[model samples]
Target: MVLVDAAFIIELLLKYSFPVLRDENDRIFNKPLMLQDVWSHLQLLENQLSFFILEDLFVPEKIPVSSYGEDAEKLSIISLSLELFTSLMHIEGIEENLKTITSTFC
Candidate 1:
């Protein structure tokens, strides 16, 4: 969860500097938009995260890594992300949030 939050913060930095990609008349292009508009979208994301996550609980337990050939850091990240996703699914009102997300995004 901490890593996810850090990545989001990093993405917001490019929200102003990066060009917005658009699809129009079956053609796609990058266009610059107002910084205020980008700020509002980023603010909305912050609000949604707060609304969805009711509690933040962290249990720090070390995972043992094999001494042989596998990559330790990559395996650790994948394991952590899966654990976080499973817990997030059980949060209150998560069903409604998932429904809203499917309609809004997909």
Candidate 2:
């Protein structure tokens, strides 16, 4: 269950980072509200997979840096997680708050 959860989150992030990778038939991205629903579910504390598990499973070193272009820093699980979560927020300085939360955990 843990691995499945982690994989799902990681896959969603990848699809988000590179829209070219998103399948035309994928219901998650195709349905107007599905992606938002998924994001909301991710906000639930009990639904989270530990960052360590995600990082370890992500294998960042194996992925080519060139694929991320100049913003290679965004390739990390932390950045991807932030990009996803921050999209749901309308608050000012939410990125800073999210960074603080992540730093506390790391």
Candidate 3:
């Protein structure tokens, strides 16, 4: 399983580039669970990414939804991705956090 960053996934959606999606050598697993946010973001973006996901990677079982934060609310890919990017842009030790997450998953 190949874990992908939510931000990268959104980039793929916005850019309409799915080179990673097309990789048949490994099964794709979007981590730090955020499916709803991804759907919501795509919805706002004129259904571009939604269309791609539906046509390309629509495996219900593979799309895992994990809990987050105090409420243990389920995160979507869009929110997660935006949060990740926003935090990284503002935080001082973001490089370290980025390295840790990327090394652990990607």
Candidate 4:
């Protein structure tokens, strides 16, 4: 159920982020647009990371946090997710993505 919720959230947001591209002839196109180079890869990774954070955040309350020494698996996973999020947020473009995400949610 948790996994389903996470997947749903990620997919929904991805649908909302329809990227468009323009050609030298001033023609605009979507999805089928060709993307290459390190910069493009970085942008793609940043978006994916942002989406992962968004997915996890949508149901933070669903992550069970048990007492000390009493079934901590879920809690640990949640912590790890947040840790990764914070670490990735330090990346250049990711901050913008996070800010956009935060603004949208709040």
TM-score of each: 0.21, 0.76, 0.24, 0.22
Candidate order by lDDT, decreasing, is 2, 3, 4, 1
Error of 1 at 25 (Å): 16
Q: 98, model 3: CA deviation in Å?
A: 22
Error of 3 at 40 (Å): 25
Estimate the overall C-alpha local distance difference test score of candidate 2.
Answer: 0.78
Against the true structure, what is every candidate's RMSD? 17.0, 3.2, 13.9, 14.6
Q: Rate the local accuracy (lDDT) of all candidates.
A: 0.36, 0.78, 0.40, 0.39
Q: Write the per-residue lDDT of candidate 1 for residues 34-88, one digit (tens) a residue.
A: 4344345545644445422222322212323322244332223223433334443
Writing each residue's lDDT as its tens digit, candidate 2 over 1-106 gives 9999998888898788767767789879899999889978988999977778998899766655536667566777887877766676643566777678778987
Badly placed stretches (over 4 Å) of model 3 are 1-74, 91-106
Candidate no. 4 TM-score: 0.22
lDDT of 3 by residue, 56-104 (tens): 4433234322221332231334333445445434545455675576567
Candidate 3 global TM-score: 0.24
When 3 and 4 are scored with TM-score, the better candidate is 3
lDDT of 4: 0.39
Candidate with the greatest lDDT versus the true structure: 2
User: Model 2: number of clashes?
Assistant: 0
Q: For model 4, how big is the CA root-mean-square deviation? A: 14.6
**What's the true lDDT of residue 17 in model 2?**
72
